[model samples]
Target: MLRITDARTGDPVTATPARRGLTRVEARVERPDATGLRVLLTADVLVRALEIGGTPVWTVLTGTEDRAELRARARALGIRPFEDERDGGPGPGLGEAQVLRVCARTDEPAGGLCVEVAPADIENGVALDDGSATALRLALLARPRGTELRLDAADLADAEKQLKHWRGAVAGWATRPSGPIPDPVRDQLRAAWEDDLDVPAVLGVLRKVETSGTVPDGARFETYAYADRLLGLELTRDIGRGTPA
Candidate 1:
């Protein structure tokens, strides 16, 4: 039931695994630039979502980019390591798995669905490596995949603030007995991520849940914990810190 907008057809397509029990995904990350990082992040998100839904994923990262730096940054961003990491030019021999060409729009499509990501326009004083890596991730996820990411100091600051608030809130809620996630909220969260990985929409659901008076605190905690499985935001990190003051 996982649907993603195919860059080739420009339409939503069901991502069916070629193999019965496993899905093979290849992501071409050409450079260690901003767009390249975005590509890596996007591919990671897709792979994680598939795995979360009970599909074993075999991920391959192939490109001429500096593998060391790329792997380092991916780890910093909380992206898991790919199963097959190789360095080569285009046309690496691939299996029947779905292919994702993560590159700029101007780059030639490497024979799969092209995920076009524009380079981030960071402000003069803003350094991507400076502050909270999790916040940087949130800022990136806030935008649609194909849109230009105009990251600035304000965006990073806001993302950091929101991340802190959510962690604190989750911690406070965790003090109460755990409760089941409401069916409607759970459905909404699943629908958002399943629909072409609409992470922004998923985040919107979290925002609403945060302020909803009807959802008991325990349920709120469970809701966030459920969403974090796909979000990878570490939303429950503060659970043992005893709620923030």
Candidate 2:
């Protein structure tokens, strides 16, 4: 089960509004038997943890941050001065220093994650070639407090595939419903769908029965009262629970 947060208030939200813009959303995913699993969708990072034996693997791709940022990143990964350096020995410049590059291990078989780099910064001691320097920030964001941090590389081709499938499914929903839908009641249900308050299976039923390129403005409001009421009740209950819907 999961609860999505309202981007502004941090309160739980059920659906993505078609009109009202969300500042952001973080998915609080919980499995009854699994603990410490979290999914965050933000302006910068959109990563999902895929695990086998409780080991999380994430694929990342972005082209931001500067050379200074990369150097800072190197330091964060435990890169240190050479042991042979004397008290005042000359410090190695960017060209010679090594930065710990990280890659999530899950996506390797799926054609790999294509992470971009600031190609111009390569000469500035920033190891933009591997692009793993940003992993620590993303990992820490998703890691639960008190958990030991462990990083690895993985494949992420599945991410694009999954997104494509979702888009395709949504596109199919653009067609109108077979029959008529009274305006007021459909307005209510559409609101519910926009709010993610209605049970998905029920919406599927409406879509099949209405067949008229969506809901009609007004036909039989009385006929849909029961369905409308049920969805409203469900929405109310979800709001009260403030956890899962």
Candidate 3:
């Protein structure tokens, strides 16, 4: 059962589908800019989590102008393509009413949910070009949704360093035979993501797993691969590239 904080009611609600088999979800962006990238990525995470929980999701992206550029950025960040993409309907950008209209026009059930992400407060003179897109994604996921993301160069650097370290570590761990994810760690991971997509908590769990002497290397490899299903960080990319020194 996926539980998310209801943006409308401020209460935790089960993401139940109106229809038996499909849950309709729409992610709205006011513009196809850096802030929109955050919103798109968040929605992608939500979709992945839902699918992991055995829910068939129909996802739509609204208010995108440059489809080509948006798709490129999303691909670079490991976001799956949306099933449907369209511009916003008649209204003042992507306000609540506009979101509802977009959903309605697409035959989304009344139970369908719209995820409206808040804009990130990026520092002046900070360019996303400074770091890898995957690292930028990790940096963004480190922060909670609805809060203004004060992204800076240091955050990007830390994210890049963490990604590099994890990939290299995973490469080394992959030399051993695969094992199951430890039960406690699996539960912790599920709890974090199930509780309103608490990705930072999930990352904390990974940090502990990385350093714990009790976990076998093979188990560590499995644990990271499982978590990467949700993280989309491509942590195993370094595997077969030679282990870290």
Candidate 4:
């Protein structure tokens, strides 16, 4: 339940995941210089987002406080944060600060792999879309304590195919009637689908509920998990199938 408020407006702004670690991540919004707004991070441990009651709840990351790691991550995105007192320390104060996370961004690459999207669920894995129509799934399984990605690259292709013919045959059973899932959630899911975002994974989860004879509850966090899984799975298959690079 971390909140990212607007530094200039003091409003509740959407705070995307910077990077999830277990060390001490002293996130601060350094003063915007001629370049732009400089965000700083001081952490050592990064973990996956925990979904509780359908909410992405990040854990309390406290470790050696690897400021370098966080700084490097920001740099990759073309965001430069002063490592030492080089460009002067962080701004007077952080305009925004909450439970820092390793939010996946589909717009760019992170680490070495280009994840499909950030982690929306703690149960699902991030994805790798190799510039193709397909994708691969990599579970972000942890030791039940953190949000670190727990799966290896080799295992991504082993996930069960979500779009198989047999799988679609059971859509009726898994499909939600209409009102079961809230409107806001439905809108969110709909928006994602329209953009070809994370449709299959979420719809797949709902279908699972139908197969189990349980109604699909469009829980906020669950929706996120479904979307993430679908996005990751798509890329997993894409990469696994060896689609042209």
Error of 2 at 94 (Å): 34
Return the TM-score for candidate 1, rounded to 2 decimals.
0.89
Clashes of each: 0, 26, 0, 31
RMSDs, each prediction? 2.7, 20.8, 5.9, 14.4
If scored against the real structure, what TM-score would every candidate get? 0.89, 0.19, 0.84, 0.29
lDDT of 1 by residue, 19-53 (tens): 33556566667777667777778888888788778
When summed lDDT is taken over every stretch of 10 residues in candidate 3, the lowest stretch is: 97-106
lDDT head-to-head 2 vs 4, winner:
4
| Model 1 C-alpha lDDT versus the unseen true structure | 0.78
Better of 1 and 4 by lDDT: 1
Error of model 1, residue 219, in angstroms: 1.0
Runs with alpha carbons beyond 4 Å of true place in candidate 3? 17-20, 85-116, 124-131
lDDT of 3: 0.73
lDDT of 3 by residue, 59-83 (tens): 6777667777887778888888875
Give the Å shift of residue 214 in candidate 1. 1.5
What is the lDDT for 226 in model 1? 88
For model 1, what is the error of residue 71's alpha carbon versus the real structure, in angstroms, after optimal superposition? 1.4
Point out where model 1 deviates above 4 Å.
17-20, 83-97
Clash pairs (backbone) in predicted model 3: none
Models ranked on lDDT: 1, 3, 4, 2
